[model samples]
Target: MKKIIAFLILTQSIISCSNSDDSADDNQISGGKYYAVGSTYGKNKDNNFTQLASVWIDGVPTILSNTASSSVANAVTFYNNDTYIVGTESLNNGNAILKIWKNNTGESLTDGNHTVEATDLTVNEGNVYISGNEFIGTLNSSIATIWKNGQAIRLSDKTSEANAIYVYNNDVYATGYKIIDDKKTAIVWKNGVETVLTSEQDDLESIATDIYVDANAIYVTGYLRNSFKSKAILWKNNSPATLSDENDFSQANALFVHNTDVYVVGCHIDTHQYDFVGKIWKNGTLVKEINGANPKSIIIKNNKIYTAGSGLDEKGMNDEGKIWESNLNNLDFIAKYKFPNNKVNAVLVK
Candidate 1:
């Protein structure tokens, strides 16, 4: 189930323009200068990895942790006027969970009791919403769920899952897939109602991987499978737009919209094997590749774009995690560290 997928999911990182060395001197307008939020890992063989929520200011690292433990933070969002950083902590226990830290106060909103694991979180109008799967029976069944103020709101009563979540105009949107008759169907949930964004036509699996919200639009990004390959897709208001040009396997994991422009990051696999090349698309146009990049989360702040993800090494382990700043007009690795092959799920500015 999701537990298996969570272990296999590649981990990913982040760096903002102000925090990047190359753009450290760039005189650009920003939101009074905020720091990027993400995690860091030590080594794969270590008993546990430190799930870090960091703040980078002028290319310096500021660590934020409520408690000292080896937890993996999947996503982070700054809301309620940047007073809180909401994300999930993979406890290494059977149950991973959704927790919030109030601006480096070392205080958690969860109260450190329940093991409710959250993946993606957002703050809207003083309200907090997080998306991820919750364990049904001591890590037995993971139900697709959303939590509002630490209260569970189940999306699928059965063995279903929801991963990424966003809030717009007082409405919540989440995406993942469901198991129906032993087949997976791509789905989106809005205020507890499920909508099938893609069908299980001909054993072609489609997953609604990421969700982005704007003033008048909602963008969903993922992949649509076929007999030969899986193509990257972006859904704007439920309308589909294919991104990949070649007949290769391309999947999008992160999405963002700014100033009426769309931005997405993911990987495109080579025809031979699991060798995925990192890809970033702007407004459905192919921009560039990271050569062997695998992006996990993307964000837009201060009129700049930032991405956090990892890439494969010669040993085939996803060890190198990178962060890029777009407004600086440079796509260079801001930070790189060694860890197990993990996936970075979210990014934010604090």
Candidate 2:
């Protein structure tokens, strides 16, 4: 079955945005210093591959960790004026490990025995919450996990993984996919209690990519997949709704909920299979489509929509990391930024 796995960690650049102007009108875009996360890649002097986990402050990259093998910076969060980023690094010995960096210095969280995925993260109440999976216990099946303050907690009983995590009222809510009855099913774990969000029937697979919680409801977004098509899905209060067409390849990467409306951002591959179209869905309806590249993360603040990752230029030639500011009402572009790399995995606002 097809899967729409949208995880943020760097393939290229970083992003950040301070609070926007309070008087710019609900539909206007305004911002201060912005921060983002992603990875930049190149060849080392030995012609070995190299990927640097990095964070961008004011659009300038600060390398987190450099390895001649490979390292990626995927998710970033700004807390107490410090930068926190998480990703993976492949060792020369062939073990992939998770790396978490704070203000450029780093911490290696694993023993490099099993493959680890550092998909997304959040800094809450002086503790770090990271969602991903690790392969262990002989069969090497992926096991869903959460690392809180560097301590591992299991969230699944079988082959599964978590894509996103959010903490509200001292409770942890995480989402991803689990192998249920031989089908990949979307799941939500509330403080480690299992709650299957997507149907176990009518489809071969599903993934829950991102989640948001407010005072009244829990909103989760991802995609549902079958043999031929992948459609975006939104789960609010355990009720599921399709956000994209059922006839195409589409996935919701992230979402933000405000008042009575929900904003979802994702990507769909074009029919030709060469180009990716970014998409925005509001309240289960498609409202905008961004051409040139895929977007991985989104935030709705001050009536402005902030989403960033890597995208090609207007000429469709140069690949660059970019953060776009758009009007939340009309979904019109207001500002755009281009960085030096080709694959940016994530964007976050301060």
Candidate 3:
């Protein structure tokens, strides 16, 4: 099941600002720096679609890989003025290889021994930490794995996957889920110690997509299945706080903590229309919504909220990467960047 979802989930979507006072120039704050990594699709001379791994810094895009094979840049971070990107590349043998790129130089993390992927990465004190999973055994069950400076650390015995990673005070934290009795169970690992975040008695599926740790709290955001629908949730120090109504299926993809407030970004599926609507919650309250978008990552800096994700195209057949900036006071979109024919997976603001 984890493998199925891993192959299905592509990337995150868009918010349009309506206020006349909100202009595109309002999003362009002086001296503000931002970085985003993702995959862009382009047509080749043969009229074939090709995937190009790319990174964008301050609205400028740099292609990292544009070969015949498909590639993606899933996550990006900066350390000591160097940019690092993590994602997957397709090999000629039809195997997916996990890769890390620093300053446009590529490093293979997997030798195509098995299907693997790098979901998120963080750099702390010159040490690079990555969260992902590798298939093992004949069943091809995913194992939750973290790499510290290229060293592998397995955090789960059963089928699992790590979607996000964070390093705080030299402690490694990963958020994902493990399979227990064929049920998805949300979990957070701190220094290789696992703590389940969802209730076992519910027998419903749950997953933790992202994790954030501040001086005062540890926050994880995802969703828990309830009967016929899923509910978005934010867990702080193992305590669950529901962020969406149980009547609709919703999932929180990422979260950030600023001062005393918690911000979460994700999407909710409308049962009637089957449309996915992007949403953001502040301190467990729904504060914004974007039609035809699904938010994946968020950051709050200098009293501004920046979110990166994807938005459905006019035909609703493809998704395009988008970044939205909003003022913290009114929460209205001030500026937005759209990458047509691409999907954004992660974002960083510094």
Off by over 4 Å in 3: 1-31, 43-48, 314-318
lDDT of each: 0.59, 0.71, 0.74
lDDT of 2: 0.71
- List runs of model 2 lying over 4 Å from the truth: 1-31, 43-49, 317-319
**Tens digits of lDDT, candidate 3, 69-179:** 778888876666677888887766666788889988988877887877778887776788888888888888889999888888999889988878887777888888898
Model 2: how large is the Cα RMSD against the reference?
5.4
Q: Write the per-residue lDDT of candidate 2 for residues 1-350, one digit (tens) a residue.
A: 01223321211111211111111111122355666777766654456656666777667777666653777777776666776788888778776888888878889898898888877777666778888788888888888899998889989769998888877777888888888889878899999998988553455587788887767788888777664567778898888888877666777777876667887877776645356778888888888888875677777666678888667776787767888888777788533667765346676555
Higher-ranked by TM-score: 2 or 3: 3
RMSD of every prediction? 6.3, 5.4, 6.1
Q: Which digits, one per residue and each the tens of the lDDT, describe model 1 over residues 103-190?
A: 6543344443445555666666566676777666654666788878777788987767776776666778788778776655678898
> Which prediction has the highest TM-score against the true structure?
3
CA error at residue 189 for candidate 3, angstroms? 1.0
TM-score of 1: 0.76
